[model samples]
Target: MSASYAIADCLTMLGRNLKRLRRYPSLTVMLLAVPIVFLLLFVYVFGETLGAGLGDAGRAGYLRYVLPGIVLMTVASGAQGTAIAVATDLTQGIIARFRTMAIFRPAILTGHVVGAVLQTMLIVVAVVAVAVLIGFRSGASVWEWLAATGLVALTAFAMTWLSVAMGLVSKTVEGASNLPLPLVFLPFLGSGFVPTGSMPTALRWFAEYQPFTPIMETLRGLLLGTAIGHHGAGAVAWCLALSALGYAWARRSFNRERS
Candidate 1:
């Protein structure tokens, strides 16, 4: 297909995916609920105790500290929904039908990735709004806000691509849903809820080296004026690497299915 034709195909598929999301809003709702629930739970239940660890910051301080992690967790939460959607399409004979059509084959997967990213960002916005209402304050300027938004979107795009690959490989919808569970909880294993410093030595080292930690740290720096250090580079590198790897895997899997 010509570049322009492929672009059109991708847009059509994206529109179709979005309409599906609207028709059955449950998936989006479920994706949004998990991170928001965790946000409220950790901030309300453990905020006082955990905030004390940040010196004199307390609950309000903890809210600011933890919001980045919650936001990243929200991005991760979208993986299951994307995987389920992809698996449903693949198993329902849609992929086979599309294969016979004249449209660009990869556009179908692109549609899923784009749609998931959009849903994820909307969930992020709602979560951030709730955080703001509950006293999660940030002194980030307009530029900082823009940068943070871009970073979150990039992270979501990367995770969505990986989820697409997982879905492509899944033999069942249930398997697809469960396969991305690691992505969901990875933030917790990093600096999501608590500082890496507070973790046990081995856990702390792992936390510090994980992808989410640098991403969260970069977010904290942008939003809360904390030091970003080397995290900005690390976050960009990790997102790019994951995106490339996921795209290659998903495309190879889809092509193999075609043959």
Candidate 2:
């Protein structure tokens, strides 16, 4: 009964929000468009400027090198939308109104998170389709490909929860929306584009230890059908640890919002 009640409340909230999309259809299009533009900008405009090393290695190799960065970008984009939507709700006293209702109080926010997750899944699909259309195919088996995509999706889910926490804590929409930038930057310093050994010592140290590299390493390995070179265990651990951390923080924020 409790689970059903929570789900229904969330779905109802999701339905209402979906309907609101028709008010300005461009809003949803913009969410999908920004990332596609980035893909083009990086893969074409700056592709040569970034250097020949990544490209000389073949299109597949280039995609392999930059895949993690793109994955991070997609999730970051989704999370930003999640935070903004949540902030909008809080700003307009929609949350306060819901508090007065008899339905599950927490379900309102949970609903938003669920809706964000669904949106993120859609973003992932669109990204992969665009990627494949651009010759970003993985030579791995079908199952391996699914595993790789699933790993990235898992990271996105954890990130969406973290954004929910940001939405609950930030004082303004700008604060809420842009908070994902730091998280998104993590992959850049890691082994996402270049090997950690090639980086300066300080950066190398950070890259070797930062959660992004391992996640990227893991995803790359899965996508390429290779084993994560050295930090495979650490990468898997970071995902679990980060998810737990994000969940704990989000739950605290959720509780505090009610208080």
Number of clashes found in candidate 2: 0
Highest-scoring model, TM-score: 1
Cα lDDT of model 1 by residue, 120-221, tens digit = 999999999999999988899999999999999999999999999999999999999999999888889999888898889999999999889999999999
The list of candidate 1 runs beyond 4 A from truth reads none
Tell me the lDDT of model 2 at 110.
69
TM-score for all models, in order of appearance: 0.98, 0.88
How much RMSD separates candidate 2 from the native structure?
2.4
* Range of the 10 consecutive residues with the lowest summed lDDT in candidate 1: 27-36
The residue pairs in collision within model 1 are: none
Over 4 Å off, model 2:
20-27, 46-51, 58-60, 229-232
lDDT of 2 by residue, 116-215 (tens): 7777778767876887788776768887777767777677777778888888888888888788778756767888666788789998999989887877
